[model samples]
Target chain A: MFKGKFVDNLPKIYGLYTGGFLLFFLAMMVAEKNGVSAKMIGILFLTFTIAIYALIGVLSRTMNVSEYYVSGREVPTVFNGMATAADWMSGASFVAMAGGIYYGGYTYMAFLVGWTGGYVLVSTLLAPYLRKFGCYTVPDFIGTRYGGNFARFCAVLVLVLASFTYVTAQINATGTIASRALGIPFGTGVWVGLISILLCSMLGGMRAVTWTQVAQYIVLIIAYLLPIFWISWRGDFGLFPHFTLGHEVARIVELEAQYGLVKNSAEAIKAAGVPAGLAYINVPHAAAPEGAMAAWKFISLAICMMVGTASLPHILMRYFTTPNVTSARRSVAWSLFFIFLLYFSAPMLATLSKIQLMDPNLKTSIIGKPIDQVMAIEWVKNWISVKQAFIADFNKDGILQLNEWFMRGDVVVLATPEVAGLPYVVSGLVAAGGMAAAMSTADGLILAMANALSHDVYYKMVDPKADVRKRLLVARLLLIVIGVAAAYIAAMRLTSILGAVAWAFDFAMSGLFFPLVLGVWWKRATKEGAIAGMLAGLISGTWYLIYVGPAFMAKTPWLGIDHLRFGIIGATVSLVAMVVVSLATKEPDAATQKMVDDIRIPSGKTVISHR
Target chain B: MATSKHEAHWNDTKGLMRITLALWFFFSIVIFMFGYQLNSVKVPLLGYPLSYYMCAQGSLAAFVILIFWSSGKQQEIDMKHGVSDAERTED
Candidate 1:
């Protein structure tokens, strides 16, 4: 029954994807040899992305609703895992997360916890249950489960709020990558990202998005892992042998003795240059606080991450495309397994790079001038020509001072290849991967947004009798409009990739996590209760994040009491509100109770029947 | 016949859910405690800070182990409940 005209386009789709991938690789190779500026490489990458989208257009006709949403439920679990991984990774994971580890120390492990922890919630709680309900959107789950249109409406509002905010951050990352790598204006880079997202999303719908995301995941993972492998190899070999030995460790101690204090402070040494023989293991004064307070914030952030992973709208929707509940569970296990392969390597990469920045000899070689002449030198000229500019002199003291640039966590992933003196081709691949991560996630969120707008809101809620074809058209239109809106918002605000992405987690944990979890687990949970919980979560979470979060809690706090703690607090309030309200209000009728019962147990009856 | 089959299926699902939930809760606590302990204490291993090592590397390895252990337990529960997909296919 699900098979349709679009399914026949598979061969042509394969051809287009392969051709585009090859062409991009070839173009990048040529650019690298010609000594193209980083800016030119970025422009060429954007052009290549556009060409790929055009190729997708040639293979498939204009998308209808079914094709654009859920890929008509035709995706295999393994392939879906790849697509979901791309969705899950995003530009933040691809580019900024490693940098976060570099600057934040082990504290940044919270990101991994948040991302991977969410899958556990999805697999055990949401994915299989939602699939059983046979719904296309999250609101569909709400509407069907509660037997009321209002619940669906609230679900749609929450989905849009979370997803649009999330997509804006991704677009922001794309703009940053393009401007820094290609030398284009941030606005143009954003446009480039927007055009790529629109073309990939609007043309084939979920089918195009699914395949493109799969390709993007491959590019992003390879781009992320290759540099780490190269750096590790170089470190192990004589190229950077001190990195492997305890030489840097010994030198750090020696420098402490000579300078009277550990000279690892980036700000203090910025103008003076890194003293010779001790560039590694320099802990800045700002970061060197000891005790429970440090541990408390780190642990709190990790809890937020663990809970937030499950609540993300784009990540949860991928489960709907799976063939069965069991498959959905399996896919999640695989996703986490794949995610770990890269997640573990991130800290290692950060540590290695930090060591390189601190190494005294590398600093001196790249610093170029004596300490006295260093003040007259411009920062850009010193490292632009040097092979290891990321580790070069910042203070002009002929010593390398690792301060401002090193503090920016986003550079860890971008600078890895250059840090190890790998080829420019590696950088190009990383760029492509970064683009892929952003596009894959953006496509998923845009698809969910379009579905919520067209399917749940306009059709089911507003006009139940609307023609299917017209509904499909509206869905397509909504995809384009939402994509453009996200691009516009991204262009205006949401500066850092990690910061913007983290805000989405905080929002989702606060708003949806309680409603979704309570709605699924507790039978007594009434519509009024659900609504109350959701509103409390949304208003409180948003307020704390916008007002209290930045003011009071900069990071995760101890004893469940930071900005991130608000999500748990909001979630707890939601649960209590739901229970209290449910008991206070009239119970749902027998039919609603039976519906809840059906989802709770697996009937021995076959999920599918022949005859 | 349909009623009997349905009842059996319901029983199997109940059993599986109970097992899965138990395992999930147990693991969640175990992993969380391990992470907490790692953060609170400092026992060095292999020239690196012990607590730092566990939070970064140890917890992840433990998680992978948990997945495998849970999968095995799931297989056992499926068998005991006569709900294994292979068994159903044979029927």
Candidate 2:
């Protein structure tokens, strides 16, 4: 079943991956032990990545063009799915998502809903249609459908904007991972991330990225799952046998009371290195309305997440890799299955960690320790390495107070190994996995950016006479430039991995989702309509986020608006614009009508016969 | 457009779409209601809040169920309508 020419190349890719992983791990170990700064190790890693990527570029000069671009399109479905999974995971999926859940409580589950549900829409609605059109890029589909150079240019604009925004987020996440795990300066980490992007994208286009992403996906999932399982085993050896019962309310309530927890003890428990317990008791100091509005906000966030996942550009492109429509559908299903494997466990682990932290005994032990000191003593020192300690005595009373900063959201995945007290090796593996997730996504976004520049703009729009070889050359050159540009942007702007990712998703939902969905499903959707809708969505959504979302939500009461609500408003505006403009414009001609007809009909002759 | 033999099958496909949409609506409502009721349920699993557990785990399980049921039903409907590739070839 695994037989393929690419399988022969597996050993080579594995060798490179493992070697790179080991080198980074050993360097980290030495730095942790010898009092070498994390910043130094990060700089070293960055320098090493750049050198390796450059070497690959020199070697690729001898390689054929097809092999560089799509790996001859001979990849097996299962392996392709794994690579696609890696691409989908991103730095945000590996680190930020878990952290968000750990910090935001049940509200963060919106991401899981949006992300997974989007796949269903892809498989059932969009994937098969796009695959049938047989395009190399997303812009290709738009160009062919609209049959105009202007249409192609608009597609390119959307593609680049979406991709550059996304690439910046990936690089930002890489910086966070490097700075936190290796103790590198964030700026230096950005430089390293840029070099890794250059190395991966500059060598062989889709061909190289696909195989590398598969390898990366395996590493990321293993890294994410292993520590959680290890911690679960350590925390309660009988936890598994009693998983069903242990997850129930009475047992949890009993555990909370046994732990002597106060109500709304999320912050306190996290500081104490105990899992959060659900104590129904009231904390008189609990902030905000403790009722329906809170629940409505949660629901609204979920809606935003579900809609946003469908609009992400890099994720949409994976459907193009398969041979035909059926494979695309099947591939999406497989992607969901692979994603569900980790997604289902994430919340459980978060809850369990929360409960462990809230235990009264652990709380007492943590009372006098500085927040950082507590984290170092209970988590970092025991599991990874305790390089230094910074404990804050906030209360002024001989005891140190534990607050929200001790449990920053981004720490969920990184702290998993430490929370469970797994071996140093596990922590090392998680780091590699996080890098893989970040790099795979970075590679995809860079490729999309390159394609938009070289194919859509240069070849298709600016000069239709551009030769194939020239187009290919431009694509490669653009890939390098975009990678560097994205890294620079990431270094200069943005903070926190998850924050950047959330902004990217919000942008996609607001600007792209409504236009794309309507363009496909609604016949009256004119090109003018689509263009106006995109612009309106981008402008209004951004304005609301910048001016309204934070200001009113933070300072004023009953405004009842946030980032998620901004997305909904943006989508609504886009829909209204599309409908109004379409009504005022002429209908599509016969040829355009034919294309729509073909999209709806599935009863045609087989395009790719198995026999 | 000329009427083709496939015209008869269109209704079936439309019916399938209706059913799928209905299933989506039904499950969404059920899951939401179930989530609301979870607050009252006292049962726990693995030291987690049971209500929270239902919100995270149980709702996801329902989503998976909705996917399978809807897709499988669509396939069956296609077969019955003689529109499926396998069914057409058999005929």
Using TM-score as the measure, the top candidate is 1
* DockQ of all candidate complexes: 0.23, 0.25
Cα lDDT, model 1, residue A419:
58
Give model 2's docking category.
acceptable
Which has the greatest lDDT?
Answer: 1
lDDT string, candidate 2, A514-611, tens digits? 66766556667777777777778777777777765453434332346565466776777877887898789888777676665455444454222211
- Candidate 2, B-chain TM: 0.55
Q: TM-score of model 1 relative to the true fold?
A: 0.81
* DockQ of the two-chain complex in candidate 2: 0.25
| lDDT (10s digit) by residue, model 1, range A357-420 | 4445554222223444433334324333332233434444555333322233555576557656
Off-target runs (Cα >4 Å) in candidate 2 are A1-4, A7-74, A179-184, A237-292, A360-405, A549-559, A602-611, B1-37, B42-51, B64-91
